[model samples]
Target: MKTPEAGDAIAAAPRRGPLHGLVVLDITRVVAGPYCSMILADLGARVIKIEHPDDPDYVRGFPPFVGEGDDRFSAFFAQYNRHKEGITLNLKHEAGRELLKQLVARADVLVENFRPGTMERFGVGYDTLRAVNPKLVYAAISGFGQTGPNALRPGFDNSGQATGGLWSMNGYPDRTPVRVGTIIGDVSATLFAAIGVLAAVREAERTGQGQMVDVSQQDAVLALTENAVVKYTVDGEIAGPLGNDHPFVRPYGQFPCRDGHVFFGGYNDKLWALSCRKFGTPDLVSDPEIDTMAKRFDPEVYARRVKPVVENWFRERSKAELEAMAGDDIPLCAVKNIREVVEDPHIAAREMIVDVDYPQGRIGMFGTPIKLSRTQAQASGRAPNVGQHNAEVYADLLGIDAESLQRLKSSGVV
Candidate 1:
């Protein structure tokens, strides 16, 4: 049986997404960089993922491997790497470096998440690549930005969270800081990187000149500091963790339900009155000390009156019951766990959960959340195998033959 080729598989598939004609040279691994490229690939860009011939991506060895022996695959790797062609290239070698330059010449975008100078050391940095492909959108995601004093400092999601002030704003006020459940910093940095790449790609199309997109995970997290930074800068206030509560909003935050927790809160008088009406507590709405935003949000007033009343109301009802009553009247949500989130009716109706077929079987993955009226994106296929498109990409794009491809593989140049 003939083996399937990577670029051929995507190229043969019908092109329906908005980014149909774009080509992305994906030199990223792990979360942030791969995620940015994966978004491009999902939007119908032909993303060629370049890796080292010997080591490949470290995430390929991550746990929850399926199948047996050498064929085992990592679920973690598959999560962010779907819908891209994988190719191995030993960039340390001059032959491999030239091969990448050739690919770069034809690519529209290139994304990498290595430390600041790693790509330069490999001789494939933005400066070198832009010399070859003047219109290529080059994006880099790192812990800090490219030119900061700490740009060379090793950083990860945890580092971004801690240093960017997100850690200080989470958890209860009395407890030590806690990392968020997921790597929000890494994920947000990827999203910002994608946005940067798309914007640069647009400008490049107009001017025929590509630019660099430098995204720092720490900077991304700092950008999302919300009211924390501003409050300090403006009001001389230092915000601390409020335990599931909104810092400046009363009756807003997590509360107890009969079965599980509910996130129900009111920020303004109108919503607070709506909440009071829903809970059959109209008298509280007229209470002089807690009628206004300033009064209601005051810590002492909230602890003495507002929180107790709202918490008592929610505690008596099941999450479903509360949800039914609060429908559109107030902003309330049942704090859902992973299983609940996946199985949610709203999530399913919105097509946020989708089935993706793999070699072993079908598994459900989070679907594209960017809904558009004109051109829709899709999760085209499963992740590719290691160097899965050597013959096809090299032959079709670089004009190398099957025999030469094999020779390159034997010499570890590809």
Candidate 2:
């Protein structure tokens, strides 16, 4: 596929997503905010990403570059910012702030991830933008939230994980709890912010009034701790990491194979019996000591009677061999690394990985997980260079011709 020129992509290639006609003004940088607007862009919203004229998105300077020197681009930024139009504006400048207000007046949604009062400091906060366009769905994503006591504090992905209590329940119980392998806090908050934006947009369409949608990274991560809070409250028991072992299920954890590891879930009676039969120990199914599910769940019994046999059986077989043996009867899966995942036939069949073309070459990125019957939800364009669409956007939206745009650029307002 040929790569479209930076400014021309959005104009030339029309989106066929469910939000085809929705216009989004994205004043967000980095993961949480960019990820949210990226979702909207993938779903067919016309997203216009505005960055600071002097200081662009920090990720644009990050490593893992493609091309050389002046032409080099950050693959990290590209993956999350694809399918959106790009422009630059100096929010600190009066004319620039006014320009943003004008854009907001015409936009259906505006998303920002700055600290709670950052936008308000610049005179373009939700209240200001809402006043400009009452129907605008304003989404504010932050570490704490817009109204909390900690809203003024600076926060990052790790801050969310730590503050939300997710970090306390991860990793082995004997060691210090570790943060999740990926940026779950930011990503979860992104998903929630997108949902909020969509819901607010729907309500706006119904009543011709838009409201603020505030999402906190810490709040989102706390919501994802899933029963940990209830476990502590109801049973008066604090949950800690069990080193991949389920607290209740006996044989529902990862075990080593000849080459690597595989997760086995023969915790139930029927599956346990099937697993025991497959291990060439059908007699163990009726064994008095470890026969029933309840008995198997006992840690001492599992360690003494079941773990040894299960480990011995697994150690003798490679991952592929164990998978073949388990087939569909026993719930088992070989733990795969990134390389295997990229090469797996199942992932390919589902179109979970895709490539976006750049001026220099193509960079591979994860495809959209959303599937719709009537509309497409995929990354169909490349990330734009800073201010790549300034002329196009300014001309089309604000009626700024080439000379006026050059003046604005020279004045450092754009």
Candidate 3:
């Protein structure tokens, strides 16, 4: 309950989960398969997930955990279901698809996204779970792939960012296509379905077996701009959006300040000449068209020369005094919302918000961006419930018992 600071603990720790003793099997769902099994349960994979108990997770009922006071389950389904282990099953019965093929014969991995041929019409795809785990891996994720021609349509992440042109280069050049305010194509197709299940779990730990990866969310938003596909293949120009500015960088972006907005990037020419000497205008940083960011798009010729002297010196400064008058000489920030980014003080000294508890109590929980230094990773619980590991992953990974897990949950199959 402390650590967070080295730049918000490298964006809120969690790196060590290098799939500690593997064993996934999520069977995936919303948010690109629960964000690729919560990034392989934050690198320590021991996932299990499943879910169904009379159909739950449509992001457990979506919303910042449905509240007008007591709805439950969501904070967007506990932000991609923390470190796994929930349960419940029906898999349209056959003893719950033979209890997910005997938990894929003791799984090594087996995510999913269900759509493109809905797991080969539920025989549990990947060639029937590689005949019950020939060293598994499996992954899938979808929306626009998993077998061509719009693989049975139905996507989202706003239709895979407007069919993958990333909402036609996202907002502002005469407005319209925006969408990037989160769910960036379902967290970039859940980081390419956790990099295709850690490259098929490092080739099933060196060819003991396993394969079938897939992934797609419109091919991860067209591989997130191959530099706008090499500038629309060497200039037939089509890039749009310019809302906050910066593709190359000149006094970077968003500048209000005095009690609001304060971004800033200032790419070069000595941070746009230290933002024209802290806005007193040391001669508009030698103005070759607003000193080149390929010309700050001549926004009304640099807003009649330097946006009214940096918007009247940020109307007398305060986004922490123009972020302490641009310290590292540039690269600053401040445009926050969502209650100033969940009470940010560097997002609470970088734990990016923690405290979990669940059934909707302590709350918070939104960390992990990636960091390592001796294998960090976190969010060890919360987001379980529905069948919540029905008697510990059904008598330890299907060795069954407890009256065959209560006659497979009174024969509903779980």
The numbered model that scores best in lDDT is 2
Which whole-number lDDT from 0 to 100 does residue 175 have in model 2?
95
Best by TM-score: 1
* Cα lDDT tens digits for candidate 1, 285-333: 8889899988988989989988889888888789899989989878888
Candidate 1 regions with alpha-carbon error over 4 angstroms:
1-14
Q: What are the root-mean-square deviations of the candidates from the true structure over C-alphas?
A: 3.5, 4.6, 17.9
- Per-residue lDDT of candidate 2, residues 1-414 (tens digit): 121221222232367789987888999998999999999999999899999988999999887888888899999899889988899999999989988887777688999999988889999888888787888899999999998679888889999999999999899989999899999999999999999999999999999999999999999999998888998899999878777888778988989999999999898899989998898989998999998999999999999998888898899799999999999888998999998998889888878788777887778878788988778797656988999999888876676789998998999999
Greater-lDDT candidate between 1 and 2 = 2
Please provide TM-scores, in order, for all candidate models, with all chains considered together. 0.95, 0.94, 0.38
lDDT per model, in order?
0.85, 0.88, 0.73
**Model with the higher TM-score, candidate 1 or 3:** 1
